[model samples]
Target chain A: MSHMQWQGYLRKDGRKGIRNYITVVYLVECAHHVAREITSRFKEHPVQLIGFAGCYPNAYADRVMNSLCTHPNVGAVLLISLGCESFDRKKLEENIRQSGRPVNSIVIQEAGGTRKAINDGVRWVDWCSGIIGNTMMVPMTVNDLVVGTVCGGSDATSGITANPAVGLAFNKLVANKGIAIFEETGEMIGLEEVMSSRAVNPQLAIELKKSVEKAARYYSAMGHGSFAPGNADGGLTTIEEKSMGAYCKSGDCQISGLIKPGDRPVQPGLYLMDVVPDGEPKFGFPNINDTVEIVEMISSGCHIILFTTGRGSVVGSAISPVIKICANPQTYRRMEEDMDINAGGILTGETTLRDTGEKIFEGILAVASGIPTCSEGLGHQEFMLSYKTFTPLGPGCLPV
Target chain B: MDKLIKIHSLDNVMIVTADIQAGEHLHIRRTEYYFDKPVGIGHKVAAQFIESGGKIIKYGVPIGSATEDIQMGGHVHLHNMKSDYIPTYTYEKQYPGDANPSLTNQSINQVL
Candidate 1:
């Protein structure tokens, strides 16, 4: 018998999810109010809302929406659309249906108005929630999990304690044949040489280098690196310094592949998530803030997020639980309620890195087995998606 | 005495493990050095003398170049260094190398 005791919401697509949430989606900004109103009625239930604010159709938006709607964690979907918006609601609804999830769409104009559309959406949700509540919980193990790690609000302590500790956790997770992902290529400006050297193959090493190079070009065009004032005040000096700190979240696993924002890992041991957009920097910053990266990970099928913060952040995500690992002992004390794991003990010489990593690995297992993370318990369901461009991954990006 | 931990064997700088005050001394590798200014936790202190425009090596790689010659035990940070790829920003004022990296940031090794 397996020592682990966890069950997942088994999806028809052969994927299992740790949570079963009924998602309310707004196809365009014009329909956001009705979607929010519908979700507000189900505040006591596992109902969450997400949407694209652009009225002009974007292929990227369509791809992300399809991925999110059919995500293993999503039990059902209710879409709100303005009658003349450019989003392809029919295709989205059909995609969800094909994924074996209940889905419905309410066009405000056809439904007579905002109040009517919201009422209609709420009714469908009320009915679908009952049906999805019966979703089978099947046996899941460490091998069945896809986990992503990201460092936000980082300070100097981040690279030393929490980030490396998270990396250790990744190492073990990959050893156990579980999928692990780490991202923010923009912060990896100066470390490409070292990172590429760790790739599993020469082609992947080259892809890793190209990804970071793309990020460098993108940030240069935007006129600002990911480095922030808080980072500076926290003792991080240059973008390269911040990148050095942020890069450790990947741990020391042999990188398996390079994946773009909406691409899931082909077969995961370790994968680098390149969140930067392709082409000229027309879409502004690759990701405006931290939550955007969280959403991207979720869209790519991450079961959970291990978020390490030295400066402290209190946000989570709509479809996944964010496990907050605080790196600074002082910051952990001030934000105790927000943080889940205190990896800061490494700095005080109270805990060893291996032990902290073991705790984080166990935390991932515990959270997966139905324990609410600090973010989940606090009802923090932050999500964001914006238009960006990308060419499909080259064959060299992911090799067996 | 505060502990300055070197993250890598080749690191020329060490990360301060605790909030430190000016004139506080640290003993590392048989050498004693005193802080020149109050430094917060996570700040870097030079492990050796680094000349202006030389690499600020950490984690065994150069994160950036020093803007001024830093003595052993001196604080190593923004005032004394900047990124070769792009200028780091703070709320106080925007650094000049961001929009035009060719101008301000071109002083060091151009890139990786």
Candidate 2:
């Protein structure tokens, strides 16, 4: 067994959380400033401000909220409601409580006013902090880790370098009995046959194929293949070519299961996150941008996110840490400050893919043990969510 | 060793990756190419001569049917190739976007 180098906050659910965060959540965009004030007042308490600003109720929003509220990292939740918004603060509070975490809800209108709400929120936070300070720490090992990988702003070098290198890291993690996940089903199009074959069960293989086919049909209907404008400039000719490269990130591990947004892995192994909505495209795209993907991974119980970028993305999640891996040597040269690992060294012929992957694996350990990523250190806690919907996974989807 | 060059195994034309001076002999995979002109990378050469409206193929996919007869080893992208399927767009035909939505609930103070 791998040695447990770091101790994490032990939860009643038997999960290890990397951080104990007190979140002041706003129910709608209207309450954001007040929620921010509540969190800002407690700057020394590791308090974070996060919430859904949508007045419209959405299934995707609910899914995201459910997963996030119960995320292992969060120890206490304080929901700030405008009192008249569509957001179901009751449900959000209930979910957090169900996770055995401390939760409080304050409706601003019902609480008298903004000043009273913030004061009440701060007092609640202070009391929660005293209680949270008593949670015990448990030893954690590699096998206990839930890691997610996402490749964004990709170019030709992405498939050949950072993506495949992350794949190697994923394989290593899975070999260590850790839970590994990869998303962006639309990018995995043309390689479904190759990908499906890696599923642990035949039923899962069929589900995998169906998901990719659905994504392809969806994109085709949009009159745009997952083809990006930058893709042509980077020398990728087709979606199939991109898919073949993107699929390498899974590192030949047996796909233990398939999950939709906010679903955690049932067993430790490799998993594919189907980011495309079920049925048709009613809820817009699966993710509005890459930050949404990172948020989903964190919600799925990931302690850390391994983000690979060819063109480069500086944004990180509001919760879990994002370790950005740079794929292109040129992009790294241009944006060194935004990158965490220079997988681009592979393109310069200075390092092998395995070497960079090992570097990333080491980086994961460091982040897990409290080392800050570029975004985390720079204080870039970007968050976003839009209206969307999904039908839950079928029995065939989880062949584990 | 015999030289061989197949632009696309399915298409008659071949792409020239290196310089080929006229009368200079070169070998590819197994077939030999007797160069007529020095061909550069991304350049195409005629595998055979044909009249207008002949079909052109690359990588085994029919890029487009030729509008006019062409010779082998000629360029096979855009100018000569046309998509067999005309593209169409409709709002009702929107594709599914990224669906992974995670709730970022940050609960800090109330630790029980």
Fnat per model, in the order given? 0.61, 0.00
Residue A7 lDDT in candidate 2? 79
Q: What are the models' TM-scores?
A: 0.85, 0.77
Clashes of each: 1, 41
Candidate 2 yields a Cα-based lDDT of 0.73
Q: Which regions of candidate 1 are displaced past 4 Å?
A: A1-5, A225-239, B1-14, B20-40, B44-112
TM-score: which candidate is best? 1
Clash pairs detected, candidate 1: B67-B80
For all candidates in order, the CA lDDT equals 0.84, 0.73
- In candidate 2, what are the lDDT values of residues A1-400, reduced to their tens digit? 3433687888878998887888778889988988998888776666888888888888778888878877778888899998999887787788788889999998999999999998999899989988997878888777778999887887666776787788888988988888998888877765666677788889999888778767766665555545565654443444444465677777776888889878888678999888777777775666778887888788788888998888888887777888999988789999999899998776555777678889888888888777789988777777776666678887966544
Question: How would you encode candidate 1's per-residue C-alpha lDDT over A202-294 as one tens digit per residue?
Answer: 988988988887776677667764656888887888767778887878877689999877787758589998888888777787888898899
Error of 1 at A279 (Å): 1.3
How well does candidate 2 score on lDDT at residue A257? 88
